[model samples]
Target: MIEFLLTLAILAGINVLLACGFNLILGYGGLVSVAQPVFYAIGAYSSALLSMKLGLPVPLAMVLGALIAAIASFGLSLPSLRVSGDYLVIASMGFQLGIIHIINNVEFTGAASGLSGIVSAIESPWRSQIYAGTIIAICAVTILAIRWLVTGPYGRAITAMRNDEEVFASLGRDAVHIKVTLFAVGSGIAGLAGGLYAHYFLFLTPDQYGIFSSATLLTMVVVGGAATVRGPVLGAIFLTVLPEAIRFLNLPIAVMAPLQGVIFTGLVILFLFVKPEGLFGSKSGGGLDAWQSRAMSSSMRKGAK
Candidate 1:
């Protein structure tokens, strides 16, 4: 029973990391990216291969894997700089699906069959406890780091850019730099979460990091309240536990899986319609508008005309 609880805790920690990293771009930077899971996959596979194949220390390999994912963030970031709103979403979706397809076909990634026997960083009998504690610590640090980031100059700059990219650039703030940097940092954090997940579970499956996973992360950010520090943390923990809580129901196996998906979709729709600001978000200026800024859409359309 303790082990099961620890497993839930570890998964929650990972989701917190993923959701918080994503919040930097989605909540604050006002960018809608469905490609976040790709970075997570990259970090997981890269860390796993490094530890399994190269025989590096699991911790070191995890860090390196995260760095690799951060570097790959440029692929989406650069192209995305020219697009906004629906175009941005389409581009991110394309990137997300394309990368997963590549992972599916790639030889070293174990292709469709998946990879296992990943080395764990903690080998003690109390492995679950240690991993759970470590992940929780990492999540705490991540939250604090992100809080500091979004509350300081970087945070203000992101807000300015989100509100008016043209004016921000005119003020010599280097909008490109901010956007790329934000992507890199956010992707890197997701990568780290991926590493933690890989080492803890000691397995990697391509299907686990697909579109639904990305949507789940996005839902956490939105439901918790975008552009707010406590929103992602609260949303991550709540959503993580909600699915587990569903297991208490007297439902069958097949029904449970689809039911969870439906619940997630319903939550997003409900929040968007009923309380777009989320539980911890402000009622104005930073809710759904932050997800896909109407201003950005208008500007993009104007530029195209």
Candidate 2:
């Protein structure tokens, strides 16, 4: 029971990290990216191969994996500057499919059979607790770092761009740069989460990081209340544990698998209809928007004075 619970906790932590990245892009940047899983795959594969094949230390490999993802994000961003909304989503989906194909065909990636024997930084018996703790600590640091970023000048700029890119442009702000930067940062976060996931499981499979995983992460961000810090974390925990809780029903594998999907999809649809802003999110706007509004109001008051 303890082991099961520990596994749940670790998965929740990873999902939280994933959801946070989605939140930054979809929630704050107002960019809908369907290619997140591709970046995640890249991270996992890069980290695993580096550690397993190249003998690099786990931490260094993880960092490099994240960096590679961030760099890849720039490629997506260039195209994004040309289109947005549904078109951007389609482009992202294309990228996702393309990457999956590459992973499946690439020999070094184990050609769809998946890669195994990934060495965990934390060794056995104590591995579970230590890994869970490390992930939690990483999540905490990420949350704080993201909070700081979203409250600063860049956050305000991105908020302006999200609300009205034309207005932001009229104010002489470079909306393109902000969007690209946020997208890269979000991808980097996803990559970091992927690295952790690879090491935790000590295995890699192309199928594991497919469109379904992207949908799940996106669902986490949406259900948790996209722009808020606590929303994704809460959503990740709920979704991660909810599936395990359902298993206690002892339903057949066929029945159980579809049932979990049905439950999760129903909840997401319900949330979309009932509270689109999410549990912790504001109906008015995201955290960035709130800060921007306050700043503008204060300036206006001073001008009046």
Candidate 3:
């Protein structure tokens, strides 16, 4: 039972990082991207491979892996400059799928068979406890950093850009710089989550970082409240526990996966329609509705011009 609880806590911590990382991109930058898992995969693979092949320490490998993911984020950020809304979504999705395909086909990535034998930084009888503590620490630091970032001048610029990119640019703020920086930092955080996952599971598979995983992270942000410090954390913990809570029903194994999917889908729909602001989102109806409104306004302005 202790082990089970620890595992849940660990998963929750990882999800917290993933959701918060994405909050920077979507919530603050108002960029719609579903390619977070790509960075997650990159971090896991880079860290695992470095540890296994080059015998690098797991801690150092994780940092380098995160750095690589941050650098790779430029690929998406640069192209993103030319796209927005649905186009950006499609582009990001295509990028994600393409990366997954490459990982699936690549020999060094272990192909479809996946990679294992990830080294742990600490060898102790209380490894699970230690890992859980480490993840908690990381989560706290991440949340604090995000809070600090979004509450200062950077945050104001982000809000300005989100409201009207053209106006923000006209005011002498470099929109390109903000976009690139947001992507790099957000993707780097995701890479760190991926590194933690790799070290904990000691395994890697392309399937683990799929579209569904990306959706799950999005759901977390939307459900808990986006553009808020505590929202993603709440969403992460709730979703992480939700699956385990479902298991108590003792349903047939076949129905379990589908049931959870239904629940998640239902929750997202309910939130979108009834509480788009999410459980802890701003009272101004922020989530997807705000995004849609902003997009439509931008389009109408463009048409008028």
Candidate 4:
């Protein structure tokens, strides 16, 4: 039972990394970066290879892999000579698919067989605890940084760009710089998370990362609440932990996977209908801690009255 709960917490932490990392781009920047999974894969694969081949420490490998992946994302985000938004999304999706294809075929990554001995991703029993704590802390810091940015000159500039890039340019805010910076930061976070995932799970594969991975990351942002610090974290934690709960519900193992699917489908629908703005979204006005949010909401309502 403890093992099961431990597994759930680790899963939740990983999702937090994936979701919040992706949120930097889609949630805050309003950019449709469908290639986020690619960066995640890149981080995982890079760190894995480095640790296995070069005998590097997992921590160093993670940082290096993340930095490389971030640079790659920045390169990919260049204002297209012709593409934008959905078109960019399409392009990024293609890139993600292409990366998977390469990974699936490559011998270095164990090709179709997938990588193994990823326990190396977690150096020791304490490694998992430290990694999880570190990633969760990263989420909190990211939220604070995002909140500060949103409330400050730079963040408002991002919002201005989101609302009207042309108008932002007209106002002399250098919208291009904003876009580039956000893209880099967002992808960088994804890369960082990817590294941790690689180390924790110690196994990665081409199929493990694809359009579906990107979609999941996006879902975390939307379901958790975009444009807010706490939204993605809640989304990641809830979704990550729920699957584990289903697995442990004393059901047949064979049926558990599909049961999780049904639950996910239901939750997605419910969230969309009841709170599309997200549970912790800026638009929704807060983070988790239902009691605190309730208090804040009451105070605001009273203030309005």
TM-score per model over all chains:
0.93, 0.91, 0.94, 0.86
Residue 17 Cα positional deviation in candidate 3, in Å, after optimal superposition? 0.4
Ranking by TM-score: 3, 1, 2, 4
Predicted candidate 3 versus true structure: per-residue lDDT over 1-305, tens digit per residue = 89889989999999999999999999888999899999999988998888889999999999999999999999999989999878988899999999999999989989999986788767999999999999999999999999999999988898789878998888888999999999999999999899999999887899978888888889899888888889889998998887677877889989998998888777777777887787887767455554766677789999999
Task: Give the distance in Å from residue 56's predicted Cα in candidate 2 to where it truly belongs.
Answer: 0.2
Highest lDDT scorer: 3
How do the residues 106-139 of candidate 4 rate in per-residue lDDT, one tens digit apiece?
8998888898876365456676566567766776
Of candidates 4 and 2, the better by TM-score:
2
Computed on alpha carbons, the lDDT of every model, listed in order, comes to: 0.87, 0.83, 0.89, 0.73
lDDT ranking from best candidate downward: 3, 1, 2, 4
- CA error at residue 175 for candidate 4, angstroms: 1.7
User: What lDDT would candidate 2 get against the real structure?
Assistant: 0.83
The candidate that achieves the highest TM-score relative to the unseen native structure:
3
Per-residue CA lDDT of model 1 for 1-305, tens digit only, reads 78878999999899999999999988888777888999999999999999999999989998999999999999999999999878998999899899999999888888998888888889899999999989999999999999999889888999888877877898988989988988999999999999999998988889988888888888888889888888988889888988777877869989998998788687778877898778788766555667456576557868988
Better of 1 and 3 by lDDT: 3
Which prediction has more favorable lDDT, 2 or 3?
Answer: 3
Candidate 1 deviant stretches above 4 angstroms: 291-305
- Scored against the true structure, residue 254 in model 2 reaches a CA lDDT of 95
What's the TM for model 4?
0.86
Clashing pairs in 1: none
